[model samples]
Every structure is written in structure tokens, then in C-alpha cells.
Target chain A: MLSTLQDEKQDPRVKRTRSLILNAFMEILPEKGFQSVSVQDITEKAGINRATFYAHFPDKYALLDHSISQMFRQEIEKRMLDACHYSDENLKTLIVTVCEFVSNANSHCKPSSLQFESLVEAQVKNQLQGLLQVWLEQDDSDVDAKTAATAASWAIYGLVLQWSHDKNKKKPSAEKFADQVLPLIAVNLRLAQPA
Target chain B: MLSTLQDEKQDPRVKRTRSLILNAFMEILPEKGFQSVSVQDITEKAGINRATFYAHFPDKYALLDHSISQMFRQEIEKRMLDACHYSDENLKTLIVTVCEFVSNANSHCKPSSLQFESLVEAQVKNQLQGLLQVWLEQDDSDVDAKTAATAASWAIYGLVLQWSHDKNKKKPSAEKFADQVLPLIAVNLRLAQPA
Candidate 1:
């Protein structure tokens, strides 16, 4: 996940092309969505050639993955959650952050299309796994960090997506939902309880 | 999904190589799993050079994707579910198929590793979406078939995976579990009422 962010030191032209394509993608997503936006649409909007777009992203899906990952990382860094160790308080904050991020992301996409949701799911789960891996490694746990992280990350992203989709009359607030599911999510980590 | 099966007309040598590599992969998977089985191990096991393995698969993940997709498709065909359209009976069968498949697949690996699980998730979900899309398109519905299929397929795969992971003393059998979740899965398709 960090490799996606470490491209900042690349050739200026490469960086310029990527930013242009990503900016155009963000602009077009609200109007057309992830499914309908073609490579040509992005290149045309970005004022770049189709080949230039291809050089940067294999397809719009790649662009969406990169874009969503960047935005989600930004969300994490904003909350200062990216570098933190695991704690009950931090976990609650992380869950709330994801809830708000998924909710806002869905609302911004106009139709909340499947393509959009799936892209969000992939990117969010990926970053969540990365974050959780770091947190798990910081403590002593016999459970495999990557395994625990993968399970927890997927579970958190799935639950948050479902929570964001809920429209029941008595739907719990995001905080309440997080609190309710916290134990289920925590068990995925299997932390060696600090003696 | 059909394209994966349409490779029969390809060069006999290409078919031979793929089968060899796949056979080696399956053998190693039970011993070392998806994470630890290196490209070299597969090539050496198959009695082919590393270049031969590279020519066939970009990486083990791709191999895993292909291998899992092929096996799961066979499971679908064995049950005669591949060509059928959606019905409650079919849906229930699909759910049970996934539950049993996941359960059996997990049992084959020593640790039920994350890499193994994730690859299975991707391949199964892809096939499910394709099958659901065909079923939804065969009938009229207010819901977008692609969108509904994507949503339903992911939800079904996710729920069945969780179900397979459940070892509670009171957990239902696969058939009973399918019957229980059938309604929840059906609503995602938004099927029109039968006249």
C-alpha cells in the first residue's frame, strides 16, 4: 500500500500525467460513476492522449483503486491514526473514521453504483490491513499479524459497508454500530492480552 | 468465466504445461499452502524450467486465481448449476455449494492461510457474479442486473464464508444454513413476482 504513495519521487512528467488523470477521474466520477467512465473519457477530460492514460493506469479500475487509496490514506493521516498502535480507544476511532468515510464516499458517487462500492471495498480493506498489520506487530502476539490483519480488515470493511447501506428506521449511529461490533472485530486480531 | 474453460482448443503443449504447473501447485498447496509455494517450487515439481512457469502464470496469485476458478467451475458444472437460471432451489443449491466448497477447501490446507482464503474469495465471488447476472437477465426486474448481481454475489460469498468459519455447537448444517439465508440472498436479486 505504501508503494502506491512512494511514487512521489518519480519523473516529473510521470507524476504530472498521473495527477492529471486522477484529477479528471475524480471530476468525472460524480457525474458518470466508476462503471461508465471509460479510459477515453478520462484522457479527454484530462487533456491527455489515450496512450498517456494507459501508461499511467491500465484501466479506470486501476485509477479508482489508486484514487480511493490516496483519499483513504489521507483520511487516516488526518485522524493521526496511520501511525498509531492498537488500543480500544484507537480502534473505536478507526471504526468511526471508516464509517464516515464510506458513508461520505457513497453519497458523493450519486448512484452509489456497484463498481464504486467494490472499488471502495478493495482500497479500504487494503489500507485497513496495512494499518492493522503495523498495530499488531507493535505488540506481542502469537497470532500471525498478516493473517489477523487480513481477517480484521476485511471484516471491518464489510461491516462498515453494510452499516453504511442500512436504512432501517432505527439504524444505530455509526458510533453505536462500531461499539456493538467491536468485540466481533477484536476477536479477529486475537491479541495476547497484556498481563 | 467461460473463457477459462475455452482453452481446450489451444496448443496441446500449452495445455500440457498449464496442467503440469497446476498439478504441481495442487500437490504443493496441501503441503506448503498458497503463501509458501514459490514459483521455483512449482516449476521444479512440474519438471519445467522457471521460464516455463513464468510463461504460464505471472505469479502464484494468478495461478491460484486460475486454479481456484477452474476447480470451482468444475464444482458448479458437476452439480449442473452452471447452465441453469435462478430459482429458489438454484439459489439454495448455490449457497450450499459455496458453503461446502469453502469448508472443504479450507480443510485441505493445514492452516487455512489468508492468502489461500483470499484467492478462493476472489474466484468464487467472480463466478457467483457471472452466474447471478445470467439469472437476473433471464427475468425482468426493476433492479439493475449487473448491480444486483455484484451486490448479491458479494454478500452471498461473504456470508457463506462466515458460515463456513462458524464452529459453534449449534451451527446449522450447510443445507439448513442455505435455507435460512435463502430469503436474505433472494432479496438482493429483486426478482419480479411470478404470475
Candidate 2:
């Protein structure tokens, strides 16, 4: 569904303008806080006029919401597909995938500002929830399967959040952590369906 | 450590002032992004002079940072202690504790913006890293325990983050999820070493 948003026939100018604004937004996040940047700043940075920017995005913050949603949805889709094959041994794969997505979702390597952080995170959270929902439905009725899937999705997202801004801690591979957690989840849930 | 900080209290007036400012900060986060709330807004809400506000916190953002740090530390401590009793069928008492913490930390009854979607997640991440560093001090030759710890901590943190935020997602009991993760963590990293 996320990938389906694109239309090859849409106005070329609209796509170009939107891409330019997103690039400008990403560049500015590392250098300045989101609240500090203005619509004028974005238009100027993107080499587009105020009207051109507005036509594509209502305001600078709108651009951020759009970019974050689209990018997160895309990344989650990809990760979920790749995650289809994950088992206990190579679990770090999923963590790495999610971490890269979160890290990249931030404007540059910076933490998302208070301005759009919640909205963006909400979208990301929804995407993860959607993915988990689908993963849970794959197997028949086991109440605990749904719980495990939910745990898997949130656990990965939370870990990425920690890794992004945590200063005092050393980093870990997300995949391995996921592997470690799955069995614990499985045991506690006592799933009727065999994995 | 957090308990220590809360105990060696300063003037009641100082405590009252800080509480006022932090409450005001949470009040405005939903309406205005964290990046937008100014010191003046806080002062006006707290019914304090700008000079008095500055006497406590350097600025609006600094107050947010401080508040977030304190909040993250507080939750980390609570979760660790609450989860310590990983009894029979308790399913990683740690995981359950964090889920319970998230579920309870912000509620409609109390409505804590300190636990707002974007704020303290980073603090949780960093705090987990610190915890892992302490927990993974075991003498393992195969993997660098620090990296392993970071990975393990992040994974658990991520799990809880998702669990906390998923309003609609079916969540397992804190005991169930923790039971799932804690043992796997112990096994994978050999965290079973005697502490």
C-alpha cells in the first residue's frame, strides 16, 4: 500500500518540488532544530519560491509529516518482507533494518525535534502496528501469537529509539536482540501453534 | 541514584518552582511542538516572573531536557526494581514491569506529558544502555559484552516502547513478555553469570 502511493503519470514538477523540499528539510535538521527553521528557510534552501513550496506542501512542518510517513511506511514494508524469513539465529537482521530506518528517518543523524517527533513517531508506530497485525493473522487463533507479534514490533522500534540518542551506552545489533527476545516471548505465551 | 536525587531535596520553594515549570511544559507539548514553547509561555503559565524562571531552568528547552532526563531515570529505576522478581511464570519480570510502567506512567487519569510520545523515549534508550553495561559485565570471550549489552538493552527497550504506545494492539501481560525476553537474553549472551 505504501509503495502504491506513487503514480508515474503525476505532474513531474510536483514530484521535483516535493523532493527538493524534503532534501532541504533533511539537511537543516542536523544543523538546526525543527522549530528554528521557517517556511521561508525551506523554500530558500530548496531553491523554490514560497508559492512553489506551498503548492507541494502546505507548510514546512507538513513537508516533514509527509516525508516521515512515506519513508517509514516504505521502510517498514521492506523490513517486514525481509523479516518473513527471520528465525532465532539471524534475528539481528530485523533490528538492523529497523534501526537504519529510524536513523535515516531523522533529519540527518539528529533526533527528530519536538515539533514533528510525535507525529512522525505516530506514523511509524502505526506502520509497525500494521505490520504486526498482518504477521499475527498469518497463523490461526492463538491469542499469544498476537501478543508475540506486538512485542516483536514494539520492541524493535523502542530499541532503535534508544540507540539513536542514548549517549552513555554502547550500541547493539538489533537482530541479535530480537532473536534473544522471541524465545522469551514464545515461552511466556505458551503458544498452541508450533513455530 | 534517582532515589538519592529525590531525597537530598532543596528548598520546597525550589521544588515547587521546578514542578510548576515542568507541568506547564507538558501542558503545552500537545498544542505546540516541544521546539516551540518559549520561556515566556512557561513563566506566564506558572505565574512566575521571567527572572525567577531563569533562576531555575536556563531556558524552555533546557527544562524539557532536564525533565526528560529525570523522567527517563525515574522510570528506568522503577521498571528495574519492579521487574526484579522474575518469579515462576512471571515471564521476564523486567519486560512486564516496563509494559506496566508504560501503561501506568501516562494515563487519562493522570495524563503525564512527560511521557509524551517523543520526549523520554531517548532517555529510556540511554538508560537501558547504562543498565546493560552494568548487567553484562560477565566475562565472555565470544562477544564484547558491552556491545551485546547495548543490543540486549535496546531490544528490550524497543519491545516496551511498542507495547506502551500501541493503544489498539493486543498486549501481553508484563509478566508474559518479560518471561519471554529475560531468559533468552540470559541464554544468548550468557547473562546467567552470578551477579
Candidate 3:
């Protein structure tokens, strides 16, 4: 999936429209809750017609999902986690990425609407599962890569979600938190082999 | 959901058959990974007919889901985590319950098969969502209870999943692991309002 995305050849016009729509959505997302953001609003903000918006994303939720997925993918790619095989260090970086993503996502809106949270969850989990599968497939394990990926994806998302919610004045930074939970998460990845 | 379960009245024969089916499933799950455990196997183990098994559950997957849900619920109720509201201590107990549940579930099979992991995940995440919803409803906060509950539920399941996967010879016990993660999990519960 990462390779396909990296090498995709797209018409400049299509890319331009999609980018415009995403930028508009990101701008309005923090101002209006996800549930309140409308297709018309996005179209107006992006200086495009409603039809153009629909051509790119069927609805605002899809736009949100796509945007979040893209932003998160970039984060993963930035850390080079997307191109690497499973390693303790790579896994640690993955955790930090998720932690930062969740914290940043949460802080963007005044109070995160239900629609926003669920969309983010779906997008993040999907990508995490995909990336984990790539790493797992490179190894020979008795357990299925897809299932291991699913479990690990869920676990990584959960750990970051929990870390992002921390309100303690002394709550550890994402790096520290990721370091603390590293051992636990690395275990999920190794579940393909018996101990 | 808990209330519905507690107050339910059922035909004695119906209840008995369901119990028999569940018992048979529990006995067979470890022996035959979740994927290989057929309805025929469950019925033969339970001394019932295939039609009777179908009458209770759609298929082996449903049976696995139902049985795991019941067992995890029992685990929660046993810890009395089900009958409580949001509190740091209760959250700690919830984490402990999940850790124990994951560790014990992983230990049941030689290699935690893909089917086994997925089924356990579905059951655990569902119950965690329900339990977290109960806790969130008792609090007053800016965040939506259901959304908060959903995120928190996923995080808890993921964290425990990671903790259970740890292969370190000196890994912290479930209780100790829960203690370490309690603050992070507890913060998710208190997201609604400042306590």
C-alpha cells in the first residue's frame, strides 16, 4: 500500500482538487465540529463547486477519513516507519507517531465530536494494520500476519489513545510514554511465534 | 446491557442447552483453534444435534464470539469492575482484569492462532466498550460519553494486548503492569469534565 501510494501517477488536476478540498476541510474542522461541517461549507471554502467536492469525496466524513489517513501516512513516512521491516526501534517510532497524532488531533478542536473521534479511529487503525502487515509478511511466523497485524494495530491505537487522554500535570511526554510502553507493544508483534 | 443480562428470564431447557453449547465450545477451543472448531465438533462434544447448535448460534464464529463475550463478562463481574462508576481505582481494576484476561487467553492455546486472537479481540473490545460506556455515563464532561467510551475501550484492549504479548523473562505481572498504566487509562475516563 505504501509503495503503491509512493509511486502512484495521478493527473495534476485531480491532485489539485483533492488537495484543495482537504485544506478547506482541515480549516473548517477545528472551527466547526465534524458533524457540523457540510459539503457546501467545504466547497465554498475551497473555491470549488459542490459537484467538484462530491467528485473527490462522497461526503464530509469521507473527506475527514481521507485527510486524516493522508496526514497520518505522511507522519509515518516522515519517520520512515512506512518503508521499514518490523524492528523494536521502528515499533517504538510507530508508537510515538500514534501518540503525537492522537494528542495533536484532540487538541485541534475545542471538544472532539463523536464523529471526529470515530473517523480518526477508523483511519488510524486501518493504516496501522496495513503497515504492520507489510512488516509481518517479511517474516516467517506460525501465526497469520493479518491477524497479528489486526491485534497489534488495535493495541497501538489504544495505547496512544490512553496516552493522549492523560491530564496529569506530570504526564510523560509522547517519547517517554512510547518508551515506557515499548516492551508491551513489541510483544503483540511477536505473537506470531510461540514463546 | 448489564441490567438486561441480570434481569433476563429464560426457559430452563433453553438456558440448559445454551450452557451446554458454551461449555462444549470452551472445551474444544484450545484443542482445535477457533478456525478448525466446527459446529459438528461442538454438537458432538455437547451431545446435541447440529440443528440444535444452529438454533442457538449462526455458526462456529458466532458461538466463539458469544462464549468469549460471556466469559470476559464473567471475568469483569468477578472483579466487580462491571458494577462500578469511573474512579482511578476502578480503572486500575479494569486494566488488571484486561491484563489477566489477555495473558490467560494467550496461554490457553499453544500458539495464539489468528482465529483465536480475532475472536478474543472482538469479545474483549465489545465488552470494554460497554463497560466504559457505563463508567462514562456517570460523569459530566464536554466529550461525548459514547465516543470517549469507544476510544477508551479500544485503548484499554490494545494496552492489555501489548502487555500480554511481552516476552521478557522479568516482565511485570498483570497487576503491576496495570498499576503502571492506570494513570493513562484513568485519564481517558475523566475526559468529560475536570474532576
Candidate 4:
């Protein structure tokens, strides 16, 4: 699934084919949603045959997984978060990024279903855990990096999800919200002294 | 869904019927797994009519949700953690409770699918957040109770889940694991002094 992120360095034809499928999928997702958007719809929109579509993706769920992962990775890279270590500043930026990503996803996908939301949550959290694990391992924290990262990733995703769903017209902006919760999340990564 | 927990204080007949349905569902869940266990299977197992089952729960998913919520609440109540204010000791016990509950759920259910795991996750996390929010609110912390609880609940659930799935022979006991990560989780609720 992560390979999809590096597809740009793959064979040109494969890259172009995948791009077509992904672009078609993004276009149809808002119209039909993840659950209802059929592979045939993507094929038709991409101007590719069923065989070609299948060659690129096993099915629409895999396509959604790939698409979500790529999109989230771009968000992380855009802020250069993928290259940074654990810090309060970086963590705050990461939280804001997740908040905006989830908000965009909630609005972009019309009438998003629970299943679709869960899929997005799973994909985004998985990547968050991986990225956080890398960042924590580069630091001197004595806690289990994998476990800490897992906890932090889930916390970030869950908080951002709640923030996105807040119906209050006075809801804080993503940056402001991130600043408020940054300490709670940062402690997960920064706690415990080097043994 | 939480109302199911208070059914004990409701009419006796309602309590009896829910107990019967929940027990039958638990019995069939191990044998047939959540997805394959139909309402018919549960009804037959409980020796109750379809109408009786319907009168209790709208569908199996609701049954699953109610069952999980009740079970998790019982775990918290059993430890008397639900009645306590925020403290490191209480937090450690809560983390241990979650670890054991998740471990038990993973082992009790047969052929647990991703969907089943996710449903359990959602149900357990909901109850955890509610419980933690109450605990945090009773203390003098200035952090938003809802946001702090949301992040703590997800972190605890996510960490315990990782511990449960650890296939290594040296996986720490739930209590030991909880002790190790208590500070990481405690800070979420304890930080941000009262105004």
C-alpha cells in the first residue's frame, strides 16, 4: 500500500495508469462515495478498460486505501513533517494537518457513510503511527517507540475526528484547536527519561 | 445504547429478556462469529421467538454495541474506577482494565473480522471516553474535559490493542504494561492546571 506513494519513480506507463485510476476515483468519490462507487465507474471515468483497472487495483477498496494513503502522505510531506523529529511544534503542525485533512474529507465526500469514514480513519491512523514511530525513534525517549507512536496516532486521529464533527458554530480553527491539545499529545511521545 | 446498562433498574421483564438475548448472543458469537451469527441463530440459541428478540434489539449490530458497552462498564465498575477521581493509580488501573478487556474480547470472539473488531473498538472507546471525562471533570484540571478524555480514551485503547496483538513470547502482562505506560497516558488528563 505504501508503494503507491512512490509510484512516481515506477514505470512511466504504470504511473500514468495509476494516476488515471486515482484521478477518476477522486472525481467519482464525491458523487458516489466510497461504498457506492463501483470499479466500473472508475474505469469509465478513467477511459480505461476493466482489465486495465483491475491490473492497477484489485478493487475499489484497495483503490480507496491507496488514494487515501497517497493524499495523507502528501499532506505530511507538504509540511516536511515526514522528515522531522519529535517536537511540540512539529506535533502541533501534524495535528492541524490531520484536522484539515479530516475536515476536507468530510466535506469533499458527499453524504459520507460510517464505513467510508472508518476506512479513512484506518488508513490515516496507520500512516500516522508509522510516521510517529520514525520520529520518536530518532529521539532519546526510553519508552517503546512503537507503543508510544500507536497511542499518539490514535489520539491525534480521534481528537481531530471529534473536532471535525463539532457542530458548534464557535468551534476553534484547526490551528487553535491543535495548540490547545498539543501538550496532551506531545506527552505521549516525550514522556519517560532515557534509561 | 448506554441505556442498556441501566436496564437492571428498569422493569424485571425487560431485564430478563435483555439478559436472555445477550447471553445467547455471547454463546453464538464464539461459535459462529459476529458476522455469520444471524438473529435466527441467537433466537434459537436463547429459545426465544423472533418477535421477542426484535422487541429487545433493533438488530444484531445494536445488540453487539449494547453488549460491548455493558461488558466494558462492568469492567470499570468492578475495579471501582468509575467512582474515582483522576489519579495516577486510578489511571493505571483504567489502563490495565482496558488491556485485559481488549485481550479478552480478542480471544473470546471466534474468527473476529475487521468489522467486528472495529465495532468493539468504537463501543469500548465511547464508554472509555465517557468514564474518563467524568473522572477528569471531578478533578481541578483546566483542559477541556471532553477533548482530554477523547484523547486519553483513544490512547489507552490503541496501546492496549497493540499489546493484545503482540505475538512475542515476552509480551508484558497487562498490569506490567499499564505501569510502564501510565505516565504517558496520565499526562493527558493531568496537564493544564486549573485557571
The estimated TM-scores of all candidates read 0.54, 0.59, 0.53, 0.82
The A-chain TM-scores of all the candidates are 0.87, 0.70, 0.87, 0.89
lDDT of 2 by residue, A1-195 (tens): 123346768777776777777888777767766767888888888899888777777676567777778777666565555357424433455456566776665646354465566566556656665655564565455644544554445445554665665554554455544454444333322332322
Model 2 misplaced stretches (Cα beyond 4 Å): A1-5, A8-20, A23-36, A47-62, A68-195, B1-20, B23-41, B51-65, B71-93, B108-115, B138-145, B165-195
Candidate 4 lDDT, A35-82, residue by residue in tens: 678888899998888889888777677788777878888899989999
Candidates by DockQ, descending order = 4, 2, 3, 1
For model 2, residues B12-131, the per-residue Cα lDDT tens digits are: 888777777777766765556554567888788877787899888767656766766776566656545423332333225545655665565455224344324345555555565565
Residue A50 alpha-carbon offset, candidate 1, angstroms = 38
| Evaluation by DockQ, superior candidate among 1 and 4 | 4
lDDT of 1 at A26: 82
Off by over 4 Å in 4: A1-24, A35-61, A140-143, A193-195, B1-21, B36-59, B193-195
Clashing pairs in 1: none
- Fnat scores for every prediction: 0.00, 0.13, 0.18, 0.82
Model 4 lDDT tens row, B1-195: 223456245888777778788888888898888878999999998888888998888889889987887888888888998788878888888888888888888888878876678888998888889988998788765777888888888988888888899899988898888888787777777663321
